[model samples]
Target: MTYSGSNYRGAASVPPAGGSGGARVAAAAGGGPTRRGLIGSAIGLVASVAAAGGGFSVWSTANDANSDLDRAFDLGDLEDRPEDTPALNVLILGSDHREGNAEEDARSDTAMIMHVNEGGTEAYAISIPRDLYVPIPEDPDAAYYPDYTGTNAKFNAAYAWGGVNTTVKTVEALTGVRIDHIVEIDFNGLIEVVDALGGIDIDVEVPEGQDTVTSIHEPYREFSEGVNHLNGEEALDYVRQRKQYADGDFARMRHQQDLIKAIMDSALTAGVLTDRGKLTAFIESTSDAIKVDTDFNVVGTAIELMGLRSDDIVFMTTPNLGTGDQGGESVVIYADDPENPEASNPEAVSLWEALREDTMAEWVEDNPEAAGQDEGE
Candidate 1:
């Protein structure tokens, strides 16, 4: 269906496949990074500090700051849910919008599902590889591509074909996890957001055999080994590199995660929340760069996650069998074939079950290999 400008009055509850789904909360909204172009920055960080007693007034102020983004996009259908929900699942899409490219032509560069568990104490950012093969639901109201027949394609193609709503449906169908909110971010704006923070420090580690990673884009900035202070432009260049590293896109994903953590840390340590001037500049820069679904209450969501520290959030990739070739296309292979259970990854299925049940803390402990290692881990 086409976007009808209808706001999600409350959390939309979709039962998890094969599980007695519980009430899912929809209180927090913010950015969580995932892939090569995945950049949510600290938009949610604004509310995160609120969890630390920033107060309802501060949250209201921040919400007012982002008033323009209140209805940034029309997310087709979401029901008003009870406040007693257990967890909040947010679909954070990092879109790559190149010069002269229309929004319809943009593909999701990064697609991550961030699950904020009960009590809002822990959050998990799980990256869904853009190239993962999945079934794309038919979008009859597709704006740009009217000929879209919606068949199996790369995961990101959902956005390319019908936009964020399609991607939302595709992800829900694939993972069996209901999304409570949506945050779409243009990584291109990272230049200004990072610059606003006075630059972020990142420990750039090229593969063991390589000395440095060079930018594929213009200016070709060179990022050397060890911790480097990067301006916005240089930082963009750094996260965009994948071919230079032996792990390819995985390396890029790692860098993006590190950059995200760095941005959050920078904002908190720089006292952006305390400093009126810096806070205004940061919020302005961020609000201009991101579009949130109408239902996402910036301040309310942040207040819900007030107890969440930066460290409490962990990043990981969806369980997969690495990369493989499908129909002459390089794709990430995962156990998503429900028609043939023999073809699905048991671990992947388990992951989805854990997410729906809000048992990620236990899931991570049971499957440490699937958990992503942090910057120095």
Candidate 2:
């Protein structure tokens, strides 16, 4: 499964863009998104290619749109899941390299797991709440991770402690699901990808009460409540908006997820993959901004994902018991039982089981209320 970095077309000799070096995460000004997001560019390219019947050309493009990832990590211990199965778990991280503003430690503003059911034509992009309470594993080299007095902490705290390695480990520990592939996208990647695609159009919906609060970004523009179209910069800010909403991070999470959905929808309907000039621009920017594990075989994946499309996708939120007081800090606790927190219920276990069996639609069918939607214009 090991391959040289040179094997990847877009990533050859290119410095890894997302989570490269001492890259810290920051949202739009005024604590916009807590730190980082979803795989806007990468997801866009994959779905667009599939829709356009890219075939060999898309395979080549996917192989080339690459990133440099750590090759030595041990996935040997991960629960063995058959490769032939339609189920594929990909960790999608959106990171930013910004110097200032608020959060001392870099945290992923957005985190999502894309579960692809290739054979079934059913896929899910589930948002892992950054604020969900979880145990941050002890990492000797992780400086940003706090030596917290308590055992459990926020989910994004794993990234702050040990970057991608810690985050991936934490995800496995919490969800009991092994990630098969990783795609890390940076803020610049999102911007450049949108710009290269001749700019993306996502419907912006700032909550009802954002008229007077004012934006911290330059020009201090306020996001009006409606279906406003966005470019790269505007798109970034639109998803980063959390302070204006009552739900805070939850609202931001939905918006970020919506952005990913918007990109997928746009890629399918907008003809980016079929159009040569736009496709070239998309391929270049996407490759430049993202990084994938060395084991990721893009050509094979493109072939497997032939029939996957935007309409087939479903959005979800990790089951939770809602927010509560934990260790003195308000946190989102795991829902063993949503109504009765006293019972020893592990909601994720069943969800993970469903994912393993490639029956997520069944899980969704069982818990309809747990799902989230973009509802963006």
Candidate 3:
């Protein structure tokens, strides 16, 4: 079963005004909605099932979501990949566009790689820090920028320079891994998705000794140390906070992971999947929040990975040597050498090898620290 390539129609479809690279960045920035959303589309695509006798609604919902994604984002030119590969690597880029933040200032706030192994029973979510210093790939789409690849810049800059296409190239160049698909997540639909499911429970764990973490946004909601029910707005505020944590963005990433897992759990336990009204609302909100590459078969991949669950997925971060000051700007000192394809951070190279070879389970066991959690006693 093969799917035809999609015909995308978005801000990326039209060339930037005046053929200016800056204009391209500005155009891409304004694409996302005002309020930040969640990674709902990623789950919505696969959460549907063709039920017996009354499966038409589910089937129809999935089809609508698929069509929405098909017309979503333009991935530019990427390497053609066969659908039957032993493993799959999907690059998920989360872009945020807040009010008062100029369109030209937009950048990918979150970047994660979802690697599904050969068996499709388990998966890995590898988050790359946006500040990780890496070599920017020359944008064939917008070649106006001089020396685009000469100086190393923050990882998220790839999206600002040329949207998804440049980001894909940069990741491929850095990890030595081929990207099977691309997903651009808009942070504007989280509220609706969470609201549709009633609300989600997130266990807020403050850093070691800290008692509680307060939201930086308005109203300053305080999250105590334990399971707290979060509505759409509260969920948005909770995950958007990073400054309160000692590790900053790293802490926020973990929270985001927690939110995603919680949403899934809430849907399952709260009967969102079984209740047609809730399910419809969930799917519709999710589908509206994301765009994907043309060839990405959301339903097909979901069907192939039917039995997958939250516990089966592990979230990890790319190896880095913490934050550092580079050229007067703070950046994440990536453990790998981005300029050279053959040379990379030893541990990161091993991680990439495991991903490429479909041996991440063994790799995770051996490198527990990089697995995003400490080994239990």
Candidate 4:
């Protein structure tokens, strides 16, 4: 169970609980986050992106029964799942981990909500900035300093206080959608999967002055201006480097979102699927880095989602109302109001409503700017 190396060496897959039950996928239980791949900035983002791709089958197998999803998490006495709910809202939290210090308490640097429509035809991923000031639930026994007597803290603080449980709770309270599943992706699993699949390509949008390499971390290869083909390390550094750009975290979000698109595109590609060797390695690496809830099913659900492709997925960030000083610290605010923030913003309310109702296709047309993925890709 302890992480011995960067690649999760000697990893093996346990056969899932249902649906052609003999098949196994890598299900190594990760201890905590490390700092070396502080891609915690983007590290968890990488693995979860692949987890979304890799967990497709696993997410399907769960039928509210004794399954892998049940083995994945301890829900205690909480309700099994929400009723009248066929749609799924999956929250993926990415930690900024450092090497040789995996136990160091870390905050969720990246959080994404993937809202899948009932039919699985259209889906959208909304990236919430870590610094967005939002209400965090009280967690007396949190990993970091607990957030008792809830306050409007930075969105990332939810994970620090109570790990994925608090993060999922805070997201549900804010978005008004009950989270069906939670996946935590660590640093190593992402790099392994990307490398195992050869690599992924994404279009890097650089302005006049700055280059892709921002002097933060070394890259595997130098990234050119346009479409850059990157291996695991190179892709991690590329997306994690945000300070070099004027846009700051938002640029990093774009790169991360694009990387998700690229991963999904690559996974659904005909060549990768047909090439059993590549597909097998990719699935194993991805599943190793992921931690799912007890109720998640990989078989039955994934079959219904056969139509999912890269082009079908949409990615966008939370509508940033603007920046302002809150309690003397600068923080990102939501839309509709400058004076009052925190989910009360008109646009934010409307956005969450659309998600709850599963009416994103109509909402996308109403708000052109929030639909970033559709703008180009």
**TM-score list, all predictions:** 0.84, 0.76, 0.82, 0.76
lDDT of 4 by residue, 1-377 (tens): 11122111112232343324221222111111111122111222222222334443432322221132223444443442333245666666666654566443655677777666654456677788888888776656555667452777778778777777667767776777877656555566557656866887879867457564443665344566788777877776777766767777777777776776666556656677556566556545555555566554433334334334455556677887666778898788754343254446666778878888878888888887777635565
Cα error of candidate 2 at position 307, Å? 3.8
Candidate 1 per-residue lDDT, tens place, 1-377, comes to 11112212343222222222122223222345644335553666654443332444544456555565645666656332222235777788877775588888777768778777755556788878778777776767665663673678888788888787778778777777777678877655677678877888888978777787778788888888999999887887788788877777777777877888788778777366577666667666776767788777654454344444456567887888778888899988764563343356888878888888878888888888788643356
Name the regions of candidate 3 deviating beyond 4 angstroms: 1-46, 49-54, 79-85, 98-104, 143-149, 340-344
**Residue 135 in model 4: lDDT:** 75
Better of 2 and 3 by TM-score: 3
Cα misplacement distance, residue 297 of candidate 1 (Å): 0.4
* Residue pairs with backbone overlap in model 3: 36-187, 36-188, 37-187, 37-188, 37-190
Q: How many angstroms is residue 56 displaced in model 1 relative to the true structure, after the best TM-score fit?
A: 9.5
TM-score of 3: 0.82
Q: What C-alpha lDDT do the candidate models reach, one value each? A: 0.67, 0.57, 0.63, 0.56
lDDT of 3 by residue, 5-49 (tens): 221111112112222111011000001111133452235333322
Error of 4 at 200 (Å): 0.8
Candidate 3: 10-residue stretch with minimal lDDT: 22-31
The most accurate candidate by TM-score is 1
Candidate 4, which ten residues in sequence have the lowest lDDT sum?
27-36
What lDDT, from 0 to 1, does candidate 2 have? 0.57
How many clashing pairs does model 3 include? 5
